[model samples]
Target: MKKYNLYCIVLFLFIGAQAKAQYLQDYTGRPYYLKTNDGVQGNPLLTETWYTATVDFANGKTANAILNYNLRGDELLFKNPKDSAVLAFVEPVKSFSIKGIRLEESDQADITFASGFPAVDDQTNKTFYQVVGDGKIKLLRYYKKKVLESTEFSSQIVSRTLVTSNSYYLFANNQMVKIKPSQKTVLAAMNDKADKMQEYLKANKVDFKSDVALAKLFGYYNSL
Candidate 1:
């Protein structure tokens, strides 16, 4: 009986390890090629340098990779940990988290992303939003990049530059409430304790425009 129990335990451990297999071959896209235009001044991705990431594929597969977010493409791009070739999993990703993604220099926390939020503006349920803070109430941030082109009529030479922007949403009780990072919008979204947030901000001086500041604000709200 003891020998049978030991065999069962070993089988269970083996099954657990298989469940977490990388399954990198299932990635559904071709080798990624950067769509670089001549005279472009900035990168099209959130960070030019890749960071370690864990991706959850739509088919219940997961993998660890060296990855970056392509803001212009609105997709997550990753390369096999064993190779330098970049790739994209064209099949939708269920969710993902990248270690030390550096959304802002002041914010060092590992960033997590999720989809399936209600469609707002151009963003659909599949659009990935950065989750800020913790608890049942979450602040979601959607980062966007736009390209501006300029030309000199004499030379007719064109140059493009990428600019990034952030949009915030408050998710609570099965809803996504769009908001600015101001005291009013924040307090209104989390109106249960608007007074406390106001008082806290008066003493704390949270910078409304900063991503880290907005995250800290939601963190404080969740604590309440």
Candidate 2:
């Protein structure tokens, strides 16, 4: 009876190990090529440099590796070792961080993050948002890529142009809201502090349309 029990224990351990292995293997995404265009404004990556990342899946499983994202295709690609294939994370990813950027998946199949604002709603839709600033109030940026076609006329010649548009968002009152990258819209969204914010912007010569400038504004607001 003792021998039989020992064998059973070993079998159980083996099964557990196999299950873990299977889980990892199942989440490995297949590789594919991304479509290219000529008029894309910036590099698809948030940063040109690669960074180590921790990817969390919807099933509560996590994986660690070097990762990069292509905004144009909304693809999360990773490589584990020095000589591994760079594959995309085809599975639904809850959130992941590369370098210092933390991105979360939204209900609309978008990625979002905490804007350091107070939660005011019970909505559970996960939207992808790029957290630009985190403090008492948070600044968020939403990136989107759309294929645009334009015709150019030259000396008896015609050509087509394709470009991508990048959008921005603001997180406040426990919600992520899209807004134009302009002073009026941004200040309106922050109506409670609009007057003060406007004064601060003018004092600091902040450019509301610039991502860097917007991040600086949020940082200053949190400081106050």
Predicted structure with the largest lDDT when compared to the true one: 1
| Candidate 2 deviant stretches above 4 angstroms | 1-64, 90-127, 135-137, 150-162
Which lDDT tens digits does candidate 1 get at residues 80-145? Answer: 555677887776787889876666533746788888788888888888888875566888888888
- TM-score per candidate, chains pooled: 0.77, 0.55
| Local accuracy of candidate 2 as per-residue lDDT tens digits, 1-224 | 99999999999999999887956764577775655566444456544666776667777777776777665665667764646666777766777755554333221222233222333232233434566666665666555454554445555544443344445556665666666767777677667787788798778886665556777777777777
| Model 2 residue pairs with clashes | 106-126, 106-127, 107-126, 110-128, 111-127, 111-128, 111-129, 112-127, 112-128, 112-129
Residue 66 of model 2 has an lDDT of 73
In candidate 1, clashing pairs total 0
Instruction: Please list the residue runs of candidate 1 whose C-alpha ends up more than 4 Å from where it truly belongs after superposition.
Output: 1-30, 37-41, 57-62, 104-109, 153-155
> Residue 130: error of model 2 in Å?
2.3
Residue 193 in model 1: lDDT:
84
What is the lDDT of every predicted structure here? Answer: 0.77, 0.61
